[model samples]
Target: MNVVLFNPRAQKAHRRLPLSLLMLARVLDCEWALVDGNVEPGAEQRLDALCARPGTVLLVTVMPGPQLGVATPSCRRLKARYPGLTIVWGGYFATVYPEAAARDPGVDFVVLGQGERTLPELLDALRAGGDPTAVPGVAAWRDGGLVRGPTRASVRPADFPDPPYERLDMERYAARTFLGDRTYNHHASAGCPYFCNFCAVVNMFEGKWIPDPADHVVRIVRRLATEYRADAIEFHDNNFFAWEKRVVEVSRGITDLGVSWWGEARIDTMLGFSGATWEAMARSGLRMVFFGAESGDQDAIDGMEKGGLTVEDTRALNRLARRHGIRPEFSFVLANPGDPERDVERSLALVRDLKADNPDCEIILYMYTPVPLPGMYDEATKQGFALPKTIDDWLSPEWAGYDRRRNPRTPWITPGLVDSVYDFETVLHARYPTVSDLRMGPWQRRALRALSAARWRLGWMKAPYELRLLQKAWGYRRPEEMGF
Candidate 1:
């Protein structure tokens, strides 16, 4: 049996090694081949060629929304071309919407939640000619309906195999760096502890915050630094500071390695970290930190169920991080459902204040995208928002909030209002793109700010992608530089 895994090509500066797929490969008992759709343009053709010499060929894919749109059609085409191929779907989208995913005849099985334990067992069953229905954390069609197996228990990082970095082409993957060099991405924890309504991380992990043992994290960091000569590390955890002790231990261990690192943490969570811990982390080479501030207004924050986090907390954290010599990146969502124009202004006000306080601070603005997970998706439909009806709709860049340039997922907000906010955001990015830009002459900065204001005042504009190439030709910059 040929076990193949794929990484869907994404349009980002960094190509993340499909860490989950590599880990699954570590525990599997059969010979496996890893395929990167990003590096291999003719991935489908390669799969087709493999099927010619195979007995039972299993093609497993883990994808998010945009990739799913591309993969679903590709899978359908492959199934039609070769009937013997076994197709499996996993990852955030499939775990949240198994029934919808399995409805596509091309997908023979849906691996729910975590795949480390369930995937190997499913493969074993297939190899032994036994019923795969007994395998937990799996969803498949039976009697013309979706049948989901028992939910598998979530595992901490210690339970999984060490990340199979050997499976990826390390030289081909590079993360865009803001302060330091691009580094290898790793996670010290699993699942976010927060219950923000817009979050899909918690839902996918079954609402558990699991961290790898401190020793396990230290060992991995040391190996990456000594063996791979990694100059930096990106902790891809949803919230790296979820456990204070774990943060202290991991930071202290990596301190001697002298590798600058980055990670995301909530403002509310960071408030609890002692000054000593923050100082320790700084000495450990924590150069950059990302915060999902979500919104500036307390009301908007409450609306998202992002418990008790306020604009004040964001302000304090920005100041504190700056004091510690750690560059802070704050992200905000504009025009969320149930939020009014005044709320949008409040978020803008917060951004202006933060920039004034710390000109070097990175501010990210996003349109509130409606993700179709259990809690948030239920709320969206209840509020009369239409969910994607077919696989193609799910794949369409216009429908998914993550990829859409013009569509606003928050139906409650008018299109004109959304456009206005985005226009203001364009101005914001134009003026304060990065920390280094702070060194620009005051006159040059003021001129760009005036231009941004003029652009917004020019009225409703098409989405960025619609005008990206023209803007690029105008010598402003490319859409990719804008973090598209």
Candidate 2:
């Protein structure tokens, strides 16, 4: 079968063929083409070109909010251009809102939950000229009616075919800063074990961590580095360090392979491990690690249900990472429910303290948005805040803006906090010039200020796509060069 897998972005045009699509292609043993939705300015043009070919099935993956807006128009255009062509929509957004996604005129089938097994089955059925409505995990529009099927059983990560790395545009992705020069993406584990209120990972995977065997993980990394010439590998697991023994084994295996890699770990996992384990990781080429330290305030931490991490715990972990020469990237949320001005101030102060204490470490501050997962949205509704009426409402273009705006029942700290945090970091850098400086400089600072101002004045609603582009253009600068 001729299959085209598409990754669609909402605002900015930045996209690469997702590693998932490559895996899907290998499973079907079909001719596959991966397209970035934003490569052209208009979705119609891109969709038309893809639909122009005969006997082609388009599998479009979409994330939440404006990205859905971006993908929906394209799907609609494809349906109009080639009425016989099959259109399948998958991803987190489709999983969460299968019924709504199925209702869209452009979407023929919505694959809820993991598409690894179900997608191939649906395609095979279509190839056999079988009824798509019989496919499990599929919500389909047929005969002027919608048919929703039972959710398919989850598939183990090991069950997935090794991703078809040969099919990817390796050079294009390698040019990106985050992916690094010789980057290969692999998943050692699937699903998240945690039940954080604001997290969708658990909901997406149903609170299960289907980890691949350590040997399997080792094999993939070895191939990626030795054969694919990957300079680095990224463990795409939601929580890499959830299992201590598995992580240790993986670390040892990576060391054995003599390759560099990066992944995300919860603060608890770091604190739980011995210093020697981290040292081994560092020796094995674990150059960087990301941690989601939502807040420094203990009350806020409790509210977020982030156990095993206190302000002090984070500090100690920072020290441990520094001792091992692993660059620790800390992610912080500026606002949460019931967060007052003081909480915001304390969070900022904590960021300043961390920067002061570990000048070499990287800290990222983000404004809080209530993700539309079960627990978080339930809390938001219980608190009497206006819940996002549709999936599109959750697409926050403002996230790419410099200045933040307030929403109903959201804490007062929401407005101006982005600018305030940027300013705070700027001042902190100026006050402590001796520290390893990672601040935005004059030109970049002015650019952010201008972007922020434009976003605030014009609003993200008017030009959602442009805001995404602006975000990528100005998102990352060298820490030493950028004031914050």
Candidate 3:
């Protein structure tokens, strides 16, 4: 069977291949055509021209935000051109909200949960000219009615197929960097054991943390380096350090290969690992590491149910990573339930201190958007933050019919304010120069002020997206110097 997998773009094309489609192709054992939905302006026309082929089944993968707008229209056009083709939709968005996606006229089937086994089974049934109505994990329309199948079981990371890189556009991605120079993506483990109130990982993976064998993961990394020439890899595992022995083995294997990679690790894991282990990871080409330091305030951290690491533990983790010559990046959540002004001030102070004390430490702040999956939204609403009427409202403007709802409990700041603060932080970091003394040089400070003045003069300060696009375009033109 000929299967065409589409990746709809809400932003510029990133190098990572959609792992789900790769698993699907392996399961079906079919010839696949992969297309980037973000082509130059008339690229969709070119896509339509290519998709108008005989005996092809179109499977478009979509994410929740802006990508849905692109995917829905593209699917509609593809179905209009080839009425006999089977069009299926799956991804984060479809899995979370299958009912809304099933309502779309262009979607023939919506596969929920893990698609590894279910997708192949659906394709097999189609090949046998069997009815799709009874297919598990698939939602289909039959006889003018919607039929929802039973939920499918989740598959382990070890069970997924090796991603089909040969079938994808490698040249376009080769020009891009993975986390600023890394080039591979891997999931050594599947699922997150922690039920972070605002996370979708637990919901998607059903709170199951299954780690793949160490040797199997190492073999995959070896292939990525030898075949793909990937200098670095990003372990996409939700909690990569959940299994210590597996991490140590994988680290040793990659170190043996002389390839560098980075991944998410918990603070406790870093502290648990002896200094020698961190040294081994550094020797193995692990350049960057990310820790989920949700907040510096212990109370806010407790409120979010993230009690794994205290502020001191996080500081120690940062010091350990720096001591190993590894760059540590902190992933933090800005606001949480019952958080006060003092909490925000304390968090910012911690960030400032980290920057001052550890030059290699980088801070990434993410807003605590309440997802309706399980704990987060209900808790936030109970704390008196008004949620949007539906889940779709939380999506960004580029997505179709997205409505940004205001939170009554957190009336001190608006969602727009949070976005702007992040944007400003990016601009500030980009325009300013880092000094060994942990102070911006005079010229750097002047440049930042000048840039701020220019932005204000042109009314760009209020337009975060526009300012970001300009910055990105500028960065792309001189990527070698951009450090990204």
**Top-down TM-score ranking:** 1, 3, 2
TM-score computed on alpha carbons, candidate 3:
0.80
Cα lDDT tens digits for candidate 1, 1-484: 7877765654444455567677677777777777777666687677667655545555556455557766777778777777878888888778766767888877889898778889888988888987776899988878878887788977776686787777666766554454345467787777877777777676677568888988899899898888777778888788888888888999999999988898888888888899999999999999878898878778878877786888889999988888888888888876766655867778888888887788768876776766665554576688888766556667666666653423556557787787767666556655554543323345654555565554444533345442333234443432233222
Query: Worst ten-residue run, lDDT, model 2?
Result: 399-408
> Please, what is the TM-score per model?
0.88, 0.80, 0.80
Give candidate 3's error at residue 456 in angstroms: 19
lDDT of all predictions: 0.72, 0.67, 0.66
Could you give candidate 2's per-residue lDDT for residues 244-324 as a string of tens digits? 777778888878666677788888778778877887788888877889887878777777766556878888888888888
In model 2, the runs with Cα more than 4 Å from the true position are: 9-17, 37-47, 125-134, 140-147, 176-180, 256-258, 374-376, 387-419, 425-484
Model 2 collision count: 11
Candidate 3 lDDT over residue span 230-268, tens digit each: 676778787887876777788887786766677887787
Among the numbered candidates, top TM-score falls to 1
**Residue-pair clashes per candidate, as listed?**
1, 11, 2
Native-vs-model 3 lDDT? 0.66
- Poorest 10 consecutive residues of model 3 by lDDT? 475-484
**TM-score of candidate 2 versus the correct structure, residues matched by position:** 0.80
